[model samples]
Target chain A: MHLLAIDWIFLLEKLILIVIIISISLGVAMYSTWWERKVAAWIQDRIGPNRAGPLGLLQPLADGLKLFMKEEIFPASSNKILFLLGPCLAMLTAMMTSAVVPWASHLHIAGRDVPLQIADVNIGILYVFGVVSMGVYGVMIGGWASNNKFSLMAAVRGASQIISYELAMGLALIALVLHTGSLSLGVIVEQQAHQGYWNIVLQPLGFLIFFVCALAECNRTPFDLSEAESELNFGYHQEYSSMKLGFYLFAEYVNMFISSVIMATLYFGGYHIPFIHIADPNFAALAGFIFLFAKTAAFITVFMWIRWTVPRFRYDQLMNLGWKGLIPLALINLLITAVVILLHTQH
Target chain B: MNVTQILFWLLSALTVFSALVVITRKNPVYSVLWLIITFISISGHYILLNAQFLAVVNVIVYAGAIMVLFLFVIMLMNLNADAEPQKNKWLQFAGVIAGGCLALVIIAALKNVDAKARIAETGSDIGLIENLGKVLFTQYVLPFEISSVLFLSAMVGAVVIGKKN
Candidate 1:
């Protein structure tokens, strides 16, 4: 009976952690909008959103208010059920994938150690991959529901793009898996406890492939063909307005945040501070959790940086990279890694 | 029986029903819908087996990508419900008989094996992509490489069959 009580308490703690994570993600997404505009403005030598508050910090809040005030519009000919479902599904999957990520090591609360992650499923990496891949459905469904030819076309292109890059991403991940010999994110991070000798050193090619695929997967710039402004006029969610539009946009940023966390966890040796091992489990776990957030923030900034710097790839070129370039490169990387592991084992 | 057992029965029924609809349904859209249902129920079975990766992959590949392709092609071709050819009753009868015989054999084989709970009690680095890759490359190397070649050959065959003169 006591054991069951302890388990229930742990479960409650985990649920609270997840709720906190979700709120933090939403908050970051709101600020990200302000940061993006600021970054873009600075590049163009202009002050962005200065009217909202000091440094325009309140811009996100103002924007949220404006969205709330605006009338919700549904297209007359649209499929009402799926139209509503599209964004909700997108947001739900985006939120759910965050559960498996080990944000910190175990933390001692009231003398009982609590895991920072919501669910430390053994197949954490695959779960992340699966959820991220499902993200395409939201856009596809949204576009299809809009009952517009352009929307349908954008959705089709988006779905094809997502499916194509996933293969390359999976292949790149295979090389990393070969190196780490584990799929659990927590175990992978633990393996990379030492700083400077991260998996990035052994699998630079995999990191490159993974990062490029991340950009394509997130539908960010240089691969944001699905929503090229002049071409598609906001792409898949063009018809969306108000909070519905907000959901679509929010889901994208949340996905970006989660993928950045995944990348940090997977390749950047997540939550590991080099040569500085605080022996206390509590402090170490706290440090690791903070390190993860810090690393995730850095990746998010890099994502924004790349978005501003690079030009969008043409649709055909994007497809070519996925099918011809990245796919073949990934295969070669996997083959080489296998041979290396084989030779080492033989000796 | 407990909730898990009851849920298992429900999902198994759903899987069987969807599998039947996938083949027997005349409308291509309905076929795709049935396939998605089958995939979801299979994921339920994987949950029972404690294999999260397999469950997610079952949904991702079978429902997400494959069914999308099926739908895309059907829409592109404008396959209408009325245009679908009628199913031959004799073929249906033969299919049911074969399926029933296969199920019986499977059940009989399962009954002969000792039933034991083998739930993983320890947290071990197993069933991850890394282990799967190692096993595939080391022990199953020939089959792994051969399957890729087989896939390539099948792709070529498909292109040949699909080409418009």
Candidate 2:
């Protein structure tokens, strides 16, 4: 009976950690808008959104409020329930991916150890894949419920594109999984931190394939074929107005932010301080959090930079690149990794 | 009730409810969405059984990939309530008879099992990736490879059928 008792302290710690993590994700996603605009402006030789606050820091807030204040236009022909469920689903799935991600090293406080992550589920990476795959429903439902042809077309494109890229992404990850021999993100990060050799050294080719597939998954340029403005007109979220549209947009930024964290955590050594060791556990954990944040920020900057740098891929080109280019490359990388690991183990 | 028992009951109700909704929904898209919900609740059941790998992969494969493709086809078909073909009352009666027979078979099949067998209560490492992978690769290797080959053949058959001269 005593063994059946619940750990209230564990639940409380996880609850607090979840709240803190989601807020940080939201804040980062908000500022990611500002950062994207700044990057886009920089590339185009223009000052971007300097009006809202200093360095346009408060622009995301103003933009969010503006979206909130705008009229919500629900189409007469739309399926009301599914239409509303669409954006909510998008936001929910986007936030759900963060549950397994280890944000930093374990913190020691008041003679108790606290981990930054919410749920370090056993099948961490697979759980992320499951949630990420479910993201397509938001686009699909939003488009289908709108009862608009353009929206339907965009949704079909978005759905297929995600499905295609996920294969390459999964294949790319198989190599890393084989190398690490574990699926837990915390364990993976801990290994990288202690070993001082990031998975990137052995997984550069896989990382490149992963990076391209990630771009496709995020629906950023040059893989932004689903929302091609020249043809699909406002894309899957076309008929959405006000905060509904805002949810769709915010979900994209949230996804981008989360993917940045995932890439940093996977390829780079997440939260690992390069060439430095701190004695105090609490201070080290704090430093690790900042380090992971900086790496994630770097990845986010690269995402935005590429978005502005490359033109959108043609629909056929996007499919070809996903199915033809990246998948085979990832497969070859997997084989090479397998052989290397085999030889190393035999020695 | 224990946490495991409570969660098991909740998930079972959700699965049954959503599965019923899936069959009852007039709109094809709604039916597909409800089916996804059914699959997800089943995945929850897997989680409750401490089959973490099975649970997430169920979500990834069934609810995520297969259901998306199902929804995609239904969406593209532009099906409506008006488009649904009317079923004869006798056909419905026949379906009920068929379903009852299936249920009878299942119940009779399970009658020999221990009724008090613990499922969700025990946190078993048998479902963990390491153990599952080891067993699957060794003892069940033949079946695993055969299923993979079957999938490959099916895929190849699809491509061949889909190709135009």
Best by lDDT: 2
Q: Give the per-residue lDDT of model 2 (tens digit) for A41-90.
A: 99999999899889888999999999999999999999999999999999
My TM-score estimates for the predictions, one after another, are: 0.85, 0.97
**Top model number, TM-score:** 2
Single out the weakest 10-residue window by summed lDDT for candidate 1 chain A: A1-10
- Listed for each candidate, the true contacts retained, as a fraction, are 0.39, 0.81
Error of 1 at A51 (Å): 1.6
Q: What is the lDDT of residue A263 in candidate 1?
A: 90
Minimal lDDT window, size 10, model 2 chain A:
A1-10
DockQ, Cα level, model 1: 0.35
Q: How would you encode candidate 2's per-residue C-alpha lDDT over B91-150 as one tens digit per residue? A: 999999999999999999998987778334556788878899999999999999999999
| Number of the top DockQ candidate | 2
- State the lDDT of candidate 1 residue by residue for A317-336, as single tens digits: 99889999999999999999
Error of 1 at A128 (Å): 1.5
- DockQ for each of the predicted structures, in order? 0.35, 0.76
Q: lDDT for model 2, on a 0 to 1 scale?
A: 0.91
